[model samples]
Target: MAQRSRVRCGHGRLVALAVMAGSLVMTGAPGASAKGAAGVRPPGDGDTPMCRLTAGPFQRQVEKDLGLPQDGEQSEQDCAAIRKLQNTYGISPADGYAGLVSHRAAVVDWATRHKATLTGCAGRSRRLVCVDQTHQLLWVQQDRKIVFGPVPARTGMPGHRTRNGSHRIYRRVEKFWSSLYDAAMPFSQFFDRGQALHASYRPIFEDPGSHGCVNLRYEDARRLWSMLHVGDGVTVWGTREGA
Candidate 1:
């Protein structure tokens, strides 16, 4: 009888686990890669599904579980905070998009729990800010107060899409690709490759394109580099729709 009781307990545990898994699937959590009957991806696969619906308790739960920003939309401040992270850390710019990291769930949870507006801007920080290329603006904030700018910028082509996501600053190279550091100023340690914030003069207003890098005024690039630390945030959003 004792052995039979133990077996029953183990069976009960299995049932509980199954129930939890089912609940997660029904709620549309990330990592639930199970396809539908028609081989189509689930509703929550790409964008943050919770944002589409009205902000409420269910959305709060999803945010807590997934770490995303909540409420109706995304914001410029959010972009800046993510950008600061990307510039400071080594995370890919693509990772800044809403669904790339697990922390988005946490962000969502915090927003909901506090009854705060989900501005979609990552968060407020003295050391972080998001750049929205679509609007040609930079969202800078500290301690929740915000300042906006129509900063001049250049963007990638359609396929490139300026790599929307979070990344961190790993290194700062004064003299990049040349022996003399004085002539060329480039922030060499960005993204995973040759792209960086460097001095360019082909045309300031025109979108002078790079392979996948950000080109800035020499002074602007240096100033930004100086302002950031090794672990600062950086996010690059390609357009206004928060794509």
Candidate 2:
């Protein structure tokens, strides 16, 4: 087991949170609460509501709130576009929602605004463009191009393998703890449950070790952290076969 530490997000652009005032006002609908209510669930709580909200209005509202592109309706194409955007920036969508949901909207908005692209190659900052345990690699992009290289990395062991799906750089800390080893260590924010990308002292990369953290070079981790901000995207591509 290894010690885990928090990754510092540092200072950067301020991510704007959407105004929930309008949406918070309940219409007294079936699932909605009355006016001035605080804990009201929306129209679709446990059971999926009868009226499926169109992706068009939702997308429009998201765009208007986050100042991103209006990608038409929430068709398959729109979903794919959103997924692509999420992958490029490493954020996830809701289980059944079309576009980026409330928590992930800020990240998607930032990636869209910065015009960051998803590439098969590597980044110029010596960042790890990790898709999964087997497909992880060190990469750099120069002149707007990607370059990749094979580098050692440590991933979560069998039962505690790094989680799959899209994520974002939410809150970051300077020091973190490894629940598996109960030691202090360094880490970055990619998941909520104490998972991170950090530095490893041993040859853990050659073998599947670590509770749920992604072990990388100290400098590499810092560089990647600096390049990222809260709400930046993070897409973990699962096992190598699919990545």
Candidate 3:
């Protein structure tokens, strides 16, 4: 959930509801972990068996990305490899299912590794925060050199889609609480209206997306907060998949 006014506010009511719904759906699933953010369970929660090759929607892409047998089918090897990617990127459930979040995570990681050739954001002469909604990633660059990220990010979903354009950070709060949504928006930095780049307690790879914000991992957001100033330029481009 997100805040209603300027200055300080929480994440978002819709976001909290989405997270709650996701948690409830997985509450009793096998290998669920209750210690995840907001009581949502992670995949490798406990003594879960290995090679739970549940067929995910993005099975083929994940298989191809991991250099597995590209048959678009699940297997023990696919499960293990996909789960490793999920764990490395902090995707919840780590269940070895190549769902949308998992697929996006893999794609972002690939983009990060090859960011030297990626294009979109301009202003190489000055500090810029680049948000690529198409790939669901963000990074900082100055004088044509990357200073931070190419990190995984989650942007607004279909309806509350994040606007693409040039904006500047206008406000910041280390620990913002949204009374409207009753959730914490840690390291909130407002760049456009109520939309900011902030840390999400929920995994950033979760579905339904943020409420017109650029959601980042806690560590990523903290690092970004330290690197970006109040007036740093932010340029967002591309279209979010479902938006």
Candidate 4:
């Protein structure tokens, strides 16, 4: 039987499931905690949380991406816009800082805007998972129309670099227990050999990367689990930086 998904979201933007904070248990796959995607807990309190008043490193780039004054300076308007984007993508602290994660998410969003042309990955006529290692991002498209992602992803690194090529999702395990790593892999969808797409409880941008799987944020992985299934076309290309 096909797994019933709790949420059905659209492309460019998807609903992020609540995740429990400080619950990560690493099991060797750079994976997430056992809380899974169903961990329902709201972040912070109040309608407007306290914003980061300082300018982030990616301040200028994010300003341009959000169509704000490209002054490379943080402003009230800039914080609000950046925070909105952060909230939409489940980035924590959502304080409207143009930090690396926020900037990366913005870049991914910008890539999918206005139905922009995505250069790599095939299967235009059918469900296709596009992995662009150059950008450290992933997105799903069909009929040349993006259905999901352009989300931040951490692929294999260095010696364990993920192999690039066309493949298919051969298996899916909602909560896979990895004895090899003594860890838990949530929303695991195997596409090639031991490599699968799964949620990593730790921050997706953390260093050293995954063993071979495409590591997504827990919220992003949950959304991806809902969007993808066994047999979907998977195309991975480009070299993961430093790999």
Query: Which residue segments of model 4 deviate by more than 4 Å?
Result: 1-50, 123-125, 203-208, 217-230, 239-243
Q: Rank the models by lDDT, top first.
A: 3, 4, 2, 1
lDDT of 2 by residue, 1-243 (tens): 333433221111111011122222211112221122223224344652222123422455544434545653433333334444434433322221233232134333443344345444332233334434443433333454443223334556566667765555566654655443544555555554556666554422223345566666565666666655566444454442110
Per-residue lDDT tens digits for candidate 3, residues 103-132, read: 887887677678797789885338899999
Q: What is the lDDT of candidate 1?
A: 0.39
Per-residue alpha-carbon lDDT of model 1 for 1-243, expressed as tens digits?
111111100112233345434533332332222112212223343752222111222333334333446442333333334334333322232222233221323332343344333243463345555555554334344454443222344445445455677665555565554222122335443543434554443332222233345555555556666656666665667552211
Candidate 4 residue pairs in backbone clash: 32-201
Worst 10 residues of 3 by lDDT: 32-41
Ranking by TM-score: 3, 4, 1, 2
Off by over 4 Å in 1: 1-120, 123-126, 146-150, 178-185, 192-194, 240-243
Best by TM-score: 3
Top lDDT model: 3
TM-scores of the candidates in the order shown? 0.41, 0.40, 0.79, 0.66
Model 3 TM-score on a 0 to 1 scale:
0.79
- Tell me the tens digit of each residue's lDDT in model 4 across 115-229: 4676877863389998888778898888777888777887876776777999999989897756555456788888887788888765665445567788888888999999887
Identify the superior model by lDDT, candidate 1 or candidate 3.
3
